[model samples]
Target: MAQLLKRTHMCGVLRAENAGEKVVLNGWIAKQRDKGGIIFADLRDKTGIVQLTFDEGVPEDVFSLAQTLRGEYVIGAAGTVRERSAKNPDLPTGDIEILVEKLVIYSKAETPPIYIKDDDNVDDNLRLKYRYLDLRKLKMQRNLSFRHRIAKVTRDYFDQNGFTEVETPMLVRSTPEGARDYLVPSRVNRGQFYALPQSPQLFKQLLMVGGTDRYIQIVKCFRDEDLRADRQPEFTQIDMEMSFVDVDDVLAIQEGYLATLFREVMGVEIQLPLPRLTWDEAMERYGSDKPDTRFGFELKCLNQIPCVKDTEFMVFRNALDNGGDVRGICIDGGSKAFSRKDIDKLTEQTKAYGAKGVIWIRKEEDGYKSSVNKFFAPEQLAEITEVFDAQAGDLILIVADKPKVVFDSLGFLRRHIAGLLGLLDNKQFNLLWVVDFPMFEMDDEDGTMKAMHHPFTHPKEEDIPMLDTDPLSVKADAYDIVLNGVELGGGSIRIHDSELQAKMFDILGISKEESQKKFGFLLEAFRYGTPPHGGIAYGLDRMVMLLAGESSIREVMAFPKNQNAQCMVSDAPNAVDTAQLAELGIGLCDE
Candidate 1:
């Protein structure tokens, strides 16, 4: 028979004010300490922990049973709240203790593999395998609580702004959205499959077509892409869309929502009207579309530097002649911090990003020391030093390569150097909107134009003509919200005209038949007077991760798949019965 004990208050709810009042508490024993005459135990619930005391005044049997209480044992206690002999300044309910007169041990637990405290420092794999036990840690509890609060705030803010919460189908048709799809074979429809949505993108757009003026969905999304610290195979997105809106309108609503969210959740006031930068400007200044504005080591074009014209150095001259760029960043006080060996290590790191080599110059008291000093005369070095305004302790690092390689190599190097110097402050968040992204990019592998965001993104009105003549030069009316160097979310005004949508498909080399076969529903819906609509999807997992100050999204998620996309706790991605595969008309391929 199950023992039932009525509960009046949570373990952590008792305070000094509740002294002398009878109370019943139910929770797990966090720890137990027996001192011959009395037993003291820490009782913990989801809220927090409170100490329970069983003194000599209590019945002998109850006192003896309290001594046997071990960590994580579920118990119920009827007691009187009283002032503690020694107050624990660290805990919220530390000023009071419970004098237990009755106790019931509901369930006994074996010792947990991981400790039920913050800062356990257990291996990630072991913690994940015993996730339920791991989640009992205070840090994990706080992280999940923060995530819930954010979601609630998001809902309230959006709902108050007249957005309807709508659900889109999970088992959706697979359309190429850059990432590979996680496909599910349908047993009823033999040989046919359904793919989980990477985002509720098309559905949200269709909602605008279906006359839903404002829509929002906090939904799960799936992808088959490689994982990273901030990424997972399956994640959540706070997706939204609005009809009859321009770029400015969408930005205004999002900015307002963010301001409210930060203020309410973190109690930090976010300055309204966040800064904006064009994609070209961001790349030119920071060598990255998602620029980390927290520190300043902005890239400088060496060709624009006064000394490059007079230099006889073949590295810079050959790069310009071969249609490549010569770019460098001046690291403040880098000369004293980095030795020649450190510079050599940096040169090797650049090679990983496709740069052939890195040129380093150090400004010293006597003269400048450089890898290319032999190629340039004293006057040229002097002019170069003046160009960079190099001080005695400064170091200049340069890369000469094709534009893509130069930007990729130097941009990453800039961040790496900042990390080494401890210049990035995680406590500070710098947010900006990167707008006016290029409509298309030329794929290096196939030499074909691909949509930078998606084919549905509408090009700038004035750049529409360029689509026919110089498609690569056309800019989309797109925007991305970036925070501390990471892209938080992105969206663009979508193509509402059927003809323009078809034209976009044509530019991507999708034939009429193929377009009709794959995106026929969207095209057909567009024919029925689609409204001008656009929306953005924020990675909920990533957002929570940033808010909780966690390096990985897995920390915020309850049961996330590991780097290999395997669920450690459930041991998923396991083999199914032969009958199940046969039912679906599927056979294993013998490789």
Candidate 2:
């Protein structure tokens, strides 16, 4: 073996200015090319990649070793940085190349199952199955680096803001936070299980009660739920809680952090305070609380339009007669865009959101065309179009159903159409706070009221009186930070008063006994002196996805599970040994 080179500089740090300087670089070979007279290779590290040169002037042993270099071979090289004869304009260190004096092959790699290049068009499963190789790509390395910077920024900002970085228990008593809990069985205590913390919600609040006025933690949380592009069974949260604060106080703190983050990470300066949208207004205008404001096509209510209201069209009639709402959006210059087949596809998409069908009115050069043309005369259709403020070369899509269905269907339709039209720009960050959410939502299956956030969330002071009388009309003192149509984070003033907390449980149909059994500890803690505190938690994975210009959170994660929540690399959720299961007093059901 040759004498090893003591590392001096990173591959990406050497450029034309560092010419003639002795340097040592350690990295995996990105690619290697051998000309008859010389051998050139691109060496890559987390920072970036740089080119290395080996010609006949180099030692015979060094030249022979360089010739054997293959992709992903980890090697160390001692060389002098020199100006490159042919420069690559795209690379940061393109102006210079390394003239290898000595080389050591640290490790050799086999042919990777997947290509390491970012533009490699391969199936996602193959990429995930070989994640170690996949993460070697420059794109993946940059994303992970971006995530790290965000975490550092979060800690620094919070520390400067008087927040104490606190650690919370990962294992805790099972308490529902909307999703099913990922439970762990006890070996010591048979039949008892500890659930993973879905978020540091309760523990952070407890810290506030314990006189930790401000707390912050970048913590891991877990949930036993179905997965999607932006979700994982186990994920990290920028968890936080603060004492002596209202909704505005928490929002202000988050805004400061976000402003600092965006300016530093994305080089985008955010205006001091982001916009705020009331929940009711957002639903009515955009059909979504986390509405994307980058594009037009705001939803409009068609219930009051005379042609739509009094038309006697069976669909419209049933919706209005039953006190349901009818809402729509007009897409400019989309008249001929959606053909009958396209409209049918739109209907199929809306059906998943509980909408029976979609009604569209397209004003073409000739005349008005619609799905409801038979039910209404030509003039009436024109009147309906006029109400929607739609002109020729315009389209009006309407959903007539219950208010929930209308909002869900139309909200999704707007974003879907925007995507097709190339309007939702990932680089354009549109952030706002969605406030004044309803205190509770009705669960149709059992006709019961469930907390929109959690039972511990406090109701607005004025709305507290109405909670007993009209729970549906009451509002929670909660706020959600929305970015680009996604709920980035949310928090609320907690019900610190034990009496109020008990009342909340009662209203949610939890019997006093059931409440004591499930959330007895939280209720017990509330008995002590508790401060007025609120906090917010950001989905760190989702935040990185937005800033990294990636569509899926998997791109930003180091190791991510598939849609079925299975880790392809580790193969988790596999059967446990019978002895281990027996120790926990568990049994597996036969398939």
Residues 214-261, model 1: lDDT tens digits: 999899999999989998999999999999999999999999999998
Residue range 173-281, candidate 2, lDDT tens digits: 9987878998999998999999998988888988988999999999999988998889899999999998889988898888999999998888999997889999999
Runs in model 1 lying further than 4 Å from the true structure: 12-21
* Window of ten residues with lowest summed lDDT in model 1: 304-313
Predicted structure 1: lDDT: 0.90
- How far is 548's C-alpha from truth in model 2 (Å)? 0.7
**What TM-score do all the candidates reach, one by one?**
0.96, 0.97
User: lDDT scores for all predictions?
Assistant: 0.90, 0.90
> What stretches of model 2 exceed 4 Å from their correct place?
1-3, 365-367
lDDT of 2: 0.90
